[model samples]
Target chain A: MVEFGGWDMPVQYPAGILAEVKAVRKATGVFDVSHMGRLYLSGPKATDFLDWVLTGSASTLRVGRARYCMICNEKGGVIDDTIFYRLSEDRYLLIPNAGNRSAVVAWFQRWIDEKFSPGCTMEDVTVTTGLIAFQGPGTLETIDQVADTPLSGMRPFSWTESAIQGATVFVGRTGYTGEDGFELLVQGNDVVKVWTALTDSGSVPCGLGARDVLRLEAGLPLHGHEIDEKTTPIEAGLDRFVRFDKDYVGAAVLKDQQENGVQRRLVGFTLPGRSAPRAGYNLLHQGETIGAVTSGSYSPTLDTSIGMGYVLERYVESDTVLDLDLRGRIVQVNVTALPFYTRPRRT
Target chain B: MSPDDRRYTKEHEWVMIEDAAAKSAVAGITDFAQDQLGDIVFFELPKVGDSLTHLGKMGEVESVKAVSDLFSPIDGVVTEINEKLLDHPELVNQDPFGEGWLIKATMTDISQLDGLMSASDYDAFTAGPQ
Candidate 1:
């Protein structure tokens, strides 16, 4: 176990990281992601407030729907990546990384106070909620055994609130892995019950170890690993998630950046050998430094080395020949596109 | 759990010598090593027919948490590599001493075994090296 964002979480179980990763990729693995923060926003202006604050089109969110969004500073720099859910006309749920929970709450509080919404009120309910992700191909069957509602009817990026183990909980058809899965949000006090039930019932208990490889395999950007305050949406290749058509805190600058085009952009690549190129490894093109790697690992699924990095816009094209400074040696690399692993079953 | 039939090293590698035609020694990492590694992801193996020095760095093993250098516990030439590990590295975690055994080398010098700590000695050394 290691200390992550004030939580002591296991990096892996006795099954080892690779086994847990393969289990999730080929079958199913359960994760205790209760460390993630969950918040509730209530008021007549809840939907309007989120639409104004987030990058995605939250205005389109109907009750019982959720969408991914990024909260940005006025400079268009990401403050925290979050998921927004519209539970009702007067209520919404915002989930953010545990490390940035305080910052996100403060941002919402300040923004709402400054804008002065007559009905909008934000409450940080992170401590009251427990999050779990059961990911992989077999997750549906595992969840079906316990969930009162049929999980087969739920679509990707959608969710349903149902009763489980006599407790009201919300289940979302979303996961970090690029597989069929569900993320359950239950009350904190009910965490042990749900966890025990799932484990005793045969779902694999995975830890942070496989959680990372699964996300990396899916090409999903991690907050501290791939995205941070130093990186902008344009440079992270996350501009698609940013809505320029709508007015938000960072819209003006992002619009200018969009028109001018960012000088550097993120790209994914595969190492030529079994050796992995790690973060901070300088990316070189034609013997000149272009950028540095953000995250790198030996992809168990691809059976090759893969990584994500930022490179000069001109050098971000597919098939670009690049070299990574792996320790004192220069390792050859090929610029592949994001999502090194894409299973047909993911759809 | 250390098996009495197998010999152990302070570095957490185990070896079992058989008086076969070539006096071969089979080696694998201990459960303690796998426990510390958290999860085994990739294995970099030495090529077949490559000569290795006892206690020398032979290859590397990578896990989600960190990477570790695999050292040869006995000097000899690698007769076979666990090619199956190239695809399923988790076998090292599942059965570190059985099918997960990493390499089989012909013993060049039996004297090399003198330097390795016994199972009890290895356990003591691992508890906190003196």
Candidate 2:
């Protein structure tokens, strides 16, 4: 077990990190994501309240649908990237990163009072709930064995509540892996049962060790490691999630950036050798420091070193050659588009 | 064989002496060292002709977690460096005693190996007092 954000979480099973990584890439693996925070917001003006708080257009989501959104600070910088589920007309659930739960919740409460109707109520449901993500090609089969409800009709980013072991649980069609999977949210007491149910049926128990590699290979962004308060969604190649058509916080700054263009854009690259460029590595051009690596690792699937970093916009073009100052040694890297690996999402 | 009677360095490296020819010795990291490193993705090694002091930072072994310094067990001039680690570093994780073996160096002074821990002693040192 490893200490992460004050929580003792398993880094790998006895099967080992490499085995867990390959298992997820080849078959199915289950992850205990109970550390993530889940919040519930309800009130007459909940939609209006969320519309003012999140970057995406809240008006577009229908009941029972979830939208991937970003919460930005007053200065137009990202506070947290989250998924908001519109459970009903007045009830919404937000899933935030585990480490940023308190900060994000406080940010929302202060803003809601300043901008929304007084009927709104905010509740932090993280401690009361347990979250699990089953990701890989064979997740459906594995889930079918334990979950009482059939998940055939569930589409990506959609969720449905069902009873498992007499407890209310939420199963959403979402995952960090670039594969078709489900995120199960249940009562805190039932967490162990759900985790055991999946693992008992031959599914491997993956830890954060393999989780990092899987998400990296899929080109998903990680907070603190990849994105931070200084990073805007526009510069991170996530402009699709920002809706400028509606008035929202950070929209004006993003609009200005769109008009004037961004200074640095995040790009993916593969190292020339197997040596991985870790976070905080420097990116150089013509032997001069021009960018910095946010995250990198040796991809277990692609069998190469891959990394992501913010480079000057001019250098973000595909096929641009760059150098990574890895521990004072210069290593060659080629700028590639997002997602160095492009296997189809396991449906 | 287990080197049934070879001496080991505290850093999880082994030194096997060949008495037949010139009093020479071969050295490499032990099984315990490779197991702790997980998967070695890259190796930065010294050349065969490179000379070293008693204990030098001869090379590095990089795994998925981080890069670690590989220390010279018995010191002299490097006789041979494992060229295979340049392309297939995972071999180190697979067989640290054989093809995954790191380097061979001729001892500058025969007494250098005296300070190194024995196989049982090294195992205890690596295993931490238990």
Residue-level lDDT of model 1, residues A243-312, one tens digit each, is 8898888788788888899988888999864567778889997789999998888777887788999889
Candidate 2 Cα misplacement greater than 4 A, ranges? A163-167, A345-347, B1-4, B7-10, B18-21
Model 1, chain A: how large is the TM-score? Answer: 0.96
- What is candidate 2's lDDT per residue for B98-120, written digit by digit as tens? 77877776777767777877766
lDDT of 2 by residue, A105-219 (tens): 8888897888874878899988988999888878877777677787746888898987655666798888887767889999889998888887887889988878887888888
In candidate 1, position A227 carries an lDDT of 78
Clash number for each model: 1, 0
Candidate 1: stretches off by over 4 Å: A345-347, B3-10, B14-28, B38-41, B45-58, B71-91, B94-116, B125-130
Candidate 2 overall lDDT versus native: 0.81
**What's the distance in Å from true for residue A320, model 1?**
1.9
Give the winner by TM-score.
2
lDDT per residue, candidate 1, B9-89, as tens digits?
766788888665567888889988987886577788798899988778888887767778899888899988888887777
